[model samples]
Target: MSDRYELFLTCPKGLEGLLAEEATGLGLEETREHTSAIRGFAELETAYRLCLWSRLANRVLLVLKRFPMSNADDLYQGVLEVDWAEHLEPTGSLAVEFSGNGSGIDNTHFGALKVKDAIVDKLRTATGDRPSIDKMNPDLRIHLRLDRGEAILSLDLSGHSLHQRGYRLQQGAAPLKENLAAAILIRAGWPRIAAAGGALADPMCGVGTFLVEAAMIAADIAPNLKRERWGFSAWLGHVPALWKKLHAEALARAEAGLAKPPLWIRGYEADPRLIQPGRNNIERAGLSNWIKVYQGEVATFEPRPDQNQTGLVVCNPPYGERLGDEASLLYLYQNLGERLRQACMNWEAAVFTGAPDLGKRMGIRSHKQYAFWNGALPCKLLLIKVQPEQFVTGERRTPEQREREREQAALGQSEPEVDNKKVESNQAPAQIEQARLSEGGQMFANRLQKNLKLLGKWARREGVNCYRVYDADMPEYALAIDLYHDWVHVQEYAPPRSIDPEKAQARLFDALAAIPQALNVDKAKVIIKRRERQSGTKQYERQATQGRFTEVSEGGVKLLVNLTDYLDTGLFLDHRPLRLRIQREAAGKRFLNLYCYTATATVHAAKGGARSTTSVDLSKTYLDWARRNLSLNGFSDKNRLEQGDVMTWLAADREEYDLIFIDPPTFSNSKRMEGVFDVQRDHVELLDLAMARLAAGGVLYFSNNFRKFQLDEGLAARYVVEEISATTLDPDFARNSKIHRAWRLTAR
Candidate 1:
């Protein structure tokens, strides 16, 4: 009824700025931007055109009214004030969608019901009839958004979501929505490339989303050209003449564009299952002549266009969510980089990935980066120009210099700064092998290989999946490398203050460069941490928030290890022999573990058929981790986890145990404790409290990593104490005998 109406354009996060610019170009006036949404005013004709052409919007809504509300009654009254008769027929069907929560309408379902009731009541009184609810194909679709304390009611102009462009009914796992793909293409400057008659290719296209969107952009075809139904199609105030005029104009433009010479757009997918679905999507989009999808692997993907025309090479590579899945995907990203380097030279490349670190492994530097959100996961789009200068060779080269070198080679002249290199024309620049590793790196790699050769057999013969492969074996490279299943965890011992920081850094780089190549592990599987002397509870604090836990097997028990979150992984590798000893001797015995970090030993005891077990720790985080460890072994109900100061818990306990373990921290000043605990100053009193709970004939195993820890001589007078540190050493830890000091004690 009005000459202009308020419009709300909603899109995915991080695309608000782009949407605002696009809206302005679409003739939207008085524009305002918000998070994930843009608001503006537009005439009816402009609204129709926007719905037809907006490739970045998820939904286009026309606002009816904005009101203030403090409660559900206010919300109902606000809805009742609007004249529903003008928007919906009495016999028609409607759907009410409500978002946000405030003013006592905390539940979205209840909010929608209240709005629906207000509409129904008004319509029933006005015409003695009411509309029925139809969620899928509603004649009038209402949207109510509660922001702060205000209610904004609008009508949905675009039914369903704009991302569902009607062509991708069948798709592969984790397909990108059409609208998001279009946004990525625009960011990668695909339109500019297409204008120059360049070709387009997607090596890892899932379901041809990028291909379809790219073709549409290049051909100037409206994204929603084939949609038969719209939210406004059945509205009471529908303007059929204006809509028909716009629709006809769009159809003519699309037909004219299609008549032009088609662009060379292609997609290659490795999954055979996705090949037909991708082809079907292209066919449904009516761009089969402009786009073709072939079953191909990333390692062998080579797009040959007419006359060596190079366009944009875009892909949405799979970046897995799990810890184990990430390792294998490193090779996928590497292979993709290799293909781009070897096959698609002088092309513009755009890679959208949730894992930015893996994107860095592509061996090319992105000229520009754009951040976007794929649902809740943060993602990045890397724009790279596939030229020789962009390749990250050992020594970084400038574009001007590389171009000069190319010119010199063409003239059959000697080049500057030669490194006696053997270049494989087909290999990626990173794989050139000339600068693969430095002299120090090569020696370190040789040592790692030697260690693995010796340790691999011992690990298999002993059925060990977790073991220390290297521990400061070379004085120059002081890093402890341990293998947890297929993952590598490296800890760098802090260099002394007298050492030059730059030289130390160079050596560290050499060691890191050598690790993956020598061990045959992907670079993504390696987790590095700096090891320094920790004070108080510093060692227990989290170093990262990834919360990614990996599973490893040790002595027939499954254990969980957090490779990223904490300074130390949950399981202590040096304690392998002690845990196995507990498992071997825990049958029919009541076991107690004090100062239990993650309750790893308790899990071992439970697996060994302990009658009952009790574990005490001060940190709730570690106790929770311990519960998971116990539950993972199907021993949750039989085990007891006590969270408090071990000293306090032991003083309050009256139960006795047939076996006990005490592996206290070297120093802990947790706020949960009555006072600070120093292993040297408090060992006597701590052992006395633990011994009181030991039953007759019960055995106690005490161990600590405090290098200067000396067993109190008076304890030998009170009980029988035998130093068992040598016996607890496993083959992997045999080289480091002073790793921990252990003693077995029993009643005198």
Candidate 2:
């Protein structure tokens, strides 16, 4: 085997950058990050160093060979050519891991079997002793990656994922992987903080992963020092003498680190069940004296007085699932924010959470947010500078004192002190900023407050938590605002040529500012979108991909909507009236929904006791959202959602429906479709196709959002069409009657 070879260091998604940095720091050459793994070149010694020291890597794979092949037989032949005796004894045990989907051989099981057969047959022919397959830990672990007929064969230097640091003797429910917790710490700047003699804390440390990783970094202890076994132990390629020297050096460093006073590491778990397990893990890692874990709730968490006044407070807070009620979790988050503000002023913080809304409930502003994935769940690691001045202290004052502050504000008096420093002098930067907002921004803020007051009560009376609170109420703003629970969504209409673009932007910032104050929510929860003419597949283009979705209720039905992604927020508020009408009219009827963006209407119909519902849309993204909506509301087994062009699906579908809803886009020539579609130009043909799916005397709700659309008069004469535009307008969209036009049509 060559001394220098490509090392494939795999990590979790969104952690490749951190892993690459770790590999480079460990003396690897030419390190680069791809998708969820890092690639680099390292000698045998450096590769062993990574196995001992890397805190963010999942596995260290040393490539043996790379070749081209076209089929499974070719793979077998390629494997047989490699001298297996060089890496492992023919009498030893082996295990194989095969990944990658494409190529003629897509089955990983079959691929592994073929590779295994080749290895055994080659060894049996040469040495008369073939290795036995070990399903668990093996003397040699082989990894094969196949992509587009190209293969990379590598030896797994680490028997299992490096995240299993062997320190975790017991675990609680859903414990975080050790390497991921390490990534969160490194990204939060814990290494630098610890080096500077600062402390670290995890208020919600479940299994002591974060505490153990933090202690390792601060003490310069190798991450894998506690491992009892390694993949290279019994392999022929492993230079036992060289490995022994490296292990000795690592042991000396760890011994020297232990003699020094380690950075203060403390963790608190609210549940007694987790505290013992966390302590057991810390003890097993030989960190019982350095890192301590205790039972305590976040509501009462506090750092030891002997430690520094501030340090890095990092945590992996429970991100309650989207479908469950998380009322108590919100309070827990609030308490965490309070604890950080009151006790850890000047400290840095990193909160890893899947639910951002719950994070916002903390009422703290973050300096920066990094995206991460906890398995398939997209999460955010919010880096915040915990300054005490940003929180609300609720200082009480007499009415007279309040009047004085208000009058002083009116009279342009100097402001109160911040952190005991004068913050209102004209020379101060904060004062300069407070005076810099444009007039248009102030007007937009005032308008948002006005609209919120006007609609808040009406919304409460009508059980409308999600509605359009503002829709270009003043032309200068020219924006539509929506409220989905506690979140604010703003959509800016394309401005006319006569308007100045800079002024429009200032007004948008003004709106963003006013929303949090008026709605009593955090400004970080706001999502903004620009409305413009879309052609071809422009509407289907993703604006953002956080995989963030929230549940919103409408007329007693819960539907999932992604406010920060796509051109639309899944559910169209303008179609509220139409959806309600369909719900009332859909009892005991079979329903069909075409161009169903997220099947919100179909959900409504199914909730209203429709016999069965089928929704058709071309975008798989929307279809997945529709299915999630169905599952969220206990209707997963009751409805069917198909991903295909509405026209093609309609032609192939022969089942008759008692009710049908068609709401196509104004104009579309989507790449997924067979031909161009224009509601104005193709309305006749589209309606004819949809009409064929309706049962005798069945009703069809035909609609579209083309403002200037004119119905084909010939079809109207053939069918009984009643214009429902007047009744379909909700109170919030009353002034914009052209938001969407609809008509109930039945065959004559």
Candidate 3:
């Protein structure tokens, strides 16, 4: 067994320091932070100890070779020159992993393929046999990272992404990435809090990542102890006896550290869906006895009896990515701030949010703010220091006390009084008119106002902006839209639960049929078109039959709508304000519409005086409809349509546009595309490609419906993101304000 080996410990961004500290604690030298990775030299026993103890790491890789490669041929030569048989047997299966930026080789799949070919070819020529390629459950997983022109290949010691700690039994719509969650906990200073006997609590703990991570740190449990296998176990150089000895030592260390009664760690969430996964994750971490998971709202939670000791309250609250409105979110934050100040006096609080403006509404000044990437979305973990000594020992008043003082100060102040007799004389007839408006159709308007108020109250208290509003008899075709300040959230509310899907469909169709009635347009001025949902085994087997309607004027103006369709008419009504913005801003400029489903905005761009428009979409059917939309808008000759892949096309195209609208599906996988397209994971690449074709001073309007969509922080340096969700919301959605987050990106 070697006393020294080059080790590359990998962690999610912002966690390299904690992992480095952990490595140092294990007697390994501190090394530099690479892109989502850390490099160090440690003994074989130290490597094993790291695998056992590191909480924030994703995987540990043992460096085998580092060589310069100017191009693909150089990459092949360098990989082939390495001694493959010494570590991996010819009969064993192998997998290649690729990462890093600014490489001559840009394509990860291509780079991985080249590396695999080089390894196999070298083994075949030398020993007349080669390892089989197994992407899933490979015996030996190799990592090839090309930074600039330098190629560094390593043997993956961890079999999977360190995030796969074997605890998650189920997941919600958008669960936190495990490694990222661990990084968040570490960033919030969990180790120090744990050592000081401060309790750790997650108010909105989905799947209990924070709770589990806190418990693991408190108990000194090795994060990877539950993992059944590692890539190194299959390596030829791996010594079973040495590995056994290291494992035994780790077990003894864990046992020795278990002397104290478990630290107080708990997680709470309102949704029942999160309970099973939360419990499963805690149990999987072997901290079930130490941590407890419960289903409840954050507003009503009471701190435990040990209030003398400082505690940490870390929460990842919903940013209205899926539901609710801005007004509600503001109120929610206000109430949340009040509750935290009132209920958790001695506890320090850290709230992680991708949206910063909403954090401002919490009214608590953050002591420290750390930036992190939540799968490409730039998120901030705001830490608020809440020391009881400040409240008890200071002459300064609490925020509540200040409010009381202000109210007392206002007691002596008075506004100018008007003559009530003269005011009544002037307003008597107006009051009767007001009574008439309130009694007639104004009754319905009053109901709408009252409903909005009730919905607003519920949305605020629930800490959500997106929700379903149950009401009937207003504009049945109208779906109220709201955009929360944080999370670029979009929420749509239809009539109450009494109106079933079929009834809603009928009402929607009637609304489409009556666009002329609602908007006071002629039937001849309206042209309706339908969009078929994409089909596959999943969609076809599910029998998901749905289509949208596009109404066009006889004079060539298009009005695409989903009046008769199920939930949302394909057209987002909240963006009515933004469509007007396009008309105002787009002038003599080339426009690009990505993920352009119905191309309504494309029409608006053309009408707004754009010189030309190029629309790219994977759906050929939608592209055809987009063309019709152009024709209806009398700008058929002013637009170009492409019917293939966006990612591939963007990579190959050299054309630049002055304005680009990128609104992709929340989640989708097309047959033509290589893999599923996740807005969070693929945003950086998509934005990079889009920006590559953007002219100087060009603006890109990027939007997504992933409700919990987070923008990647690393990409922020390249483009500026401004939240336009608030300006896009329509009046009907005032109750739950987050309709969609729209950003105007300008290249630096």
Candidate 4:
């Protein structure tokens, strides 16, 4: 038998048991479990095997020796006393890692420096030449842990963080760590997943982490199959023949256990930016033939017939904290719930959320909720069982019925009723109509209201469910447009026939001339801002060029649009169908919106009898316009507005919203934030954050206008990202259908 030694395997928090199980499977004897670590005793060959097959461990360390150290000199002496020649070569490069809390050697770097010096000094004294320090990709890694007065030293057998499972060649923003992904699959019961023959999907899959993990589990492939080397390979006592034999034997065992394709695995998202990296990761994992990735939205995604089984859908959606606001996130969650109930009936769903209130909006009670951590923030992963029978009716139950059921259930319990009066007494009055305008501002508001009425009538007369409403009234220079649904079919207009600069100018004036008198806007108030589109500068330009337009509105909340500004200055015509969708479904639901550009959807939701509304965005200017829109429609300020980063906000909030709308900019660069945000690059983190805060039975309507967007395949397991692009296009945009893709996502 090979020499036996004690080992401590470290894993991400909550995965200690999994690592212990893996170690035991590899013939190691588990001795104990710590908070985030597992200790075991095994022969040197078993240690090599553990590094090769374990899925959830971050690293495997071989304990060298333990000693007591009260000062920095003691630390040096303890490190120098170890048999350095047993692990390090005189010509090799090494790195030392130190971790400890509440110790005299508190600074990890300083401790590491001391350890490195001692190792080199001991080696030089024994063999003249000492090993060098290599911080980046070291050949041999040493670990030092000092807890209280005790110090322990070990050699890192896993060269890199095991989370870097060799499957991913590329990554998108905040991709799920591989070890964490594997743990989630395990927690959700992967054995059951394989038996069900249902697809594994993540509708907001980013970087293919989930897809690869699923494939690995399905194929019985060891998670580290592709890893080229481990830190143990460079040790002085390394046995290449033994390790090779162990690796080859494990690979053969895994190959023998491989079965036919388990289920159809897929993912979808609206942003194209994630597709390449996702594909790269999938290909690197050797799963290019098993999993497929598509670009679409969750709002209208249809599951394949084969996927009709009660499979799992897991998603990590944006929480609106790093993305936008609670109200917008609510809108997104509501839409997600609606779509899941409509299309993916047989699927079991799991959503990882940091916000408990948002999880309530999924409408379905969770069969299991597991608490985990994404970085330092605490989060919950809710597993919801969605029976196929629940999809027979398209409509969600009324809010009154839902509330009544909760009350009855709460009262039916035999437990004594606790006094809840204090909770109610401390609650502020529901601020549903707090932002409504007074009668004094009725003149211009009335005109805008009349215009909305006319627009709705015209939409109905023409059977147009969606169209743009441009009010040129002065006070606000920005444009105010609404995407109406229900009455008018939203249509995507073809790229306007390319017109000569002069002709475009004439057309702008003509469209402006059509404003109705009841709306009461003078032509003189319209000024056209014009310029030329520079080469690289054109993409970044926000102002209109070669257009007949002028600043018309101030704070009065006027809808002044310049058609000459690129192609879409007047309105986002795609959401007309979605807004109508909200109006048809919004009765008696609370709404949340994030990155609410102008709150047009809020107006529609309120009109549809929404109980309350909250809008969040980074721009105070847009929030002001949203407030104006609510007031114009006779809706009270009961709707709240907040200006902050959505990610940070959701991390701390606990409120639940029934309807959510998430419409963020295609790309934005804020000096105060980390860096510029590209919707395609950041959708996974964004969707994860959003789903965390949705209320049960809620709907989330998420969209982005990156014309060439493609979806990430890993997200399919969490969200059923459906393509609602066909329904979102306006009639005017028939010539060019690539407007925007909208999706709805829900837990499981």
Which candidate gets the maximum TM-score versus the true structure? 1
Q: What is the lDDT of residue 19 in candidate 2?
A: 88
- Among these predictions, the greatest lDDT belongs to 1
Tens-digit lDDT string for candidate 4 (1-748): 2389889898877777776776788888955777678998998888888888778888999889889888899999999998788777778899999999445677889999999999988888544787888887777899998877898898899999888887777777677788888888878776578666667777778777887888788777888877887888778878999988988987886676454654678877667898888888888777777788888766655566643355678777775552113333443454465556545655677788777666665545677888887767778888876642222122245556446534633443211111211112223211111111122223434544565686668666666643555423332212233333311111111123453544333233222222222233332222333222223223234443445432222112233333444433433556667777777777888888887766777777888888888878666655765776676667875677777766566666778888888877777755445556677888888888887778877778888767777667677788766667788765544434665788877767
CA lDDT for candidate 1: 0.87
For candidate 3, lDDT tens digit of each residue in 1-748?
Answer: 3568888988777667777776788867747777777888887777777776676678889888899877888888899998887877777799999876454677888899999999998777455677899998898999988776788899888888778777776666777777677777777788788888888878788888778767777777677776778888888877788888878776776776666788888788878888987797677667778888889876656566664656888887766552223334444454455456555765788888876666764545677888877777788998887532222111344566545434532342111111111123234322222221212234444554555477667556644343333223365534332222111112224456676766554443333322322223332333222222332212212112446454532112455543333234445645556666777778999989888876778888888899998988887766766777777667878689887778998999999999998987766776788778777888889999999999999988888656678888776777787777777654445544644677878988
Q: Model 4, residue 599: displacement in angstroms?
A: 22
- Per-candidate TM-scores read 0.65, 0.56, 0.54, 0.56
For all candidates in order, the CA lDDT equals 0.87, 0.81, 0.67, 0.66
How large is the C-alpha RMSD of every model relative to the true structure?
9.2, 12.0, 20.8, 23.2
Order of candidate numbers by lDDT, starting with the best: 1, 2, 3, 4
Worst 10 residues of 2 by lDDT: 428-437
Off by over 4 Å in 1: 101-105, 125-128, 305-307, 396-400, 406-516, 519-748
Q: After TM-score superposition, what is the CA distance of residue 244 in candidate 4 from its true location, in Å?
A: 1.1
> What shift in Å separates residue 697 of candidate 2 from its native position after superposition?
50
Model 3 error, position 336 (Å): 2.6
